[model samples]
Target: MAASVTRVFVSHLAGLPVFDPGGDQVGRVRDLVAMLRVGRRPPRLLGMVVEVLSRRRIFLPMTRVTGIESGQIVTTGVLNVRRFEQRPTERLVLGELLDRRVQLVDSEEGATVLDVSIRRLPARRDWEIDKVFVRRGRGGALRRKGETLTVEWSAVTGFSLEEDSQSAESLVATFERLRPVDVANALHHLSPKRRAEVAAALDDDRLADVLEELPEDDQVEILGKLKEERAADVLEAMDPDDAADLLSELPEEDKERLLALMRPDEAADVRRLLSYEERTAGGLMTTEPIVLRPDATIADALARVRQQDLSPALAAQVYVCRPPEETPTGRYLGTIHFQRLLRDPPFTLVGSMVDSDLPPLAPDTPLRAVTSYLAAYNMVAAPVVDESGSLLGAVTVDDVLDHLLPDDWRETDFEESEHG
Candidate 1:
């Protein structure tokens, strides 16, 4: 092996472009494949899972790789277009190793695996797993600020995951830091039993976020598997619009049961959203956007917008309202864009900077009308009001686009993400 062959971490290698010896682009590296062996020996690199044209995932053996440089991998001229399948002896480094919880063999201290480094053996042309990177902190807090270190692969245990032996707890822990969409994708790839187990392991809020990003079918399936109280809690944790969307998929009886189980206020918001057509302004709106009394100071509005958990779309503006400032109960006044709060003196009342030039969307407005309203006004989110001019909710651009996209857009997005 060339001594100059560079070592790369699996996390960094993920999604890098791959090209053939002829310089023709083949696909992007999706995951690293390795074969588990006896004792503490590092697993040998089998190859990589490359997502090629047509979004088909195929395997490329390390022996066929000619170079790994910059952000791309170069392979020999030959290629196999067959779809990649996991053999019993193989494991995916990114999917199975990175972010997994493992134990320090000597001290029994627990660590969360962060990344794995791989390099070519000095005397052979083959590459194998080199060092395991892990994060550790005192106490049992797996996510607390911790020190990271690279140890030989033999220094750790728990790398071997037999197909039938993988536990849901570890799988959920491995995905704790991943985005909701990524977690949903990983859940989609698991077997039904494993998916249910993983879902059960996640807390209500985390499960709710993942459910929102999943397909309607998946959303219903996972929600259905939970016990009544737990399912209701998860639904309560979800955004009202998303909760309504998922409820719209359930049978009317099941819907009413779950609604009754939820807190009255949360249930009421979802019920109101459910009363509208699936594609209309009311259906696409979230009832939880920031709301402030006209008398609220710029500082107060700023404080609400600064909330760490507030969604960016909803946080972009604060709806100024009459008494009972909360949505669904207040009269529609005007909206105070976040920029106005920043430009005005902190003590200034929001009413003084309210933007009332643009009309609020009627609750029953059609989808096309909402789209046009947002586009024509260049707004990220627009407020919805009842015929009596009471504040209902706000329809965000992201929610509008979600309803407008093709039904299969999620699958298409997964394919496009391979190259991103």
Candidate 2:
């Protein structure tokens, strides 16, 4: 948390200049990232999306931020140059949360959120949204303004409840607290028109997650409803293999059109997966598995595993490669399980601790053989390599089960059956 400012409304921080320790301007704040919890709990502030001089937006983790004054922010000069990508559990304060309708818990009076104040916890680096400034009225903040008040976040109710509504805004807010599968179940029961509306309203990453859980027909319908560019963006957010599967369901022309609209790098990964037989290891593998260089330390592996966005299976181990860390990476070396990372000292070189005892799976390995490999080794995920020994991707147990399950499995109301 920034030491100079204990509490600052997010609105005030928006577009504020961000500076490094030596008084050099680095970027301007574009938005704040917050992780939403299960219930009424205030979302923890994750970091800021800062746009640098070159017009490139990057993530500035809160841990690296040192001060937040009224005019500018000060960082420890550390920054990650990767483009900011919102995860399924994250919400952007400015883009998604502002100007939304909510109700005061005690009064039940409707209000529109105008701003939110975040505060750093005592003696801790973490911050959480604590107060909300809302305007009471029927219209947005710019029009028909009425009495405004700052209330504790707990005083608001509509942000997480599944209120009865056909409007996409309310529906999206309702789905905010739900797991992707749960949201998919709710969407499955919605009228197709309503389902498309909700899907269109959700942010790209969130929509991608929910789409992955939906039935193929529903996925196709909702995707078809979105604009071509938006559809491409959502596909880019999905796992490469899942995106390839969804693209496979489309007509050849439609698939090609969407692929053409996607970023070249992202589209390339999907194209590679599409080249393989649908029932093979290559087809089932996700291209975004954690890949590390041989020179990385156990500490580095642990840090990569701690990312909140990684699926448990993907986070279960890291693949060590020669170079070009991305999938289809340089010569495949071996894998280091999470347990191995935990056992070794932080300073230990990952290359020295590599677990190369097990033979890696070939990209064309049949689905049955892939499943057998996982079961035989009790591994949650298995690496997929090509004939030339380049690491392609990793197939996880979940994708295998998705393929193995009955076609109508997702349609079953498992929650009701278990509770009944």
**How displaced is residue 336 in candidate 2, in Å?**
0.7
Q: Which candidate should be chosen as best, given lDDT against the real structure? A: 2
Off by over 4 Å in 2: 1-166, 413-420
Whole-model lDDT, model 1: 0.83
Candidate number of the best TM-score:
1
Instruction: Supply candidate 1's per-residue lDDT for 38.
Output: 96
TM-score of structure candidate 2: 0.63
Worst 10 residues of 1 by lDDT: 161-170
Shift in Å, residue 253, candidate 1: 2.5
Clash totals in order: 0, 0
Off by over 4 Å in 1: 1-30, 36-43, 50-90, 93-119, 129-165, 415-420
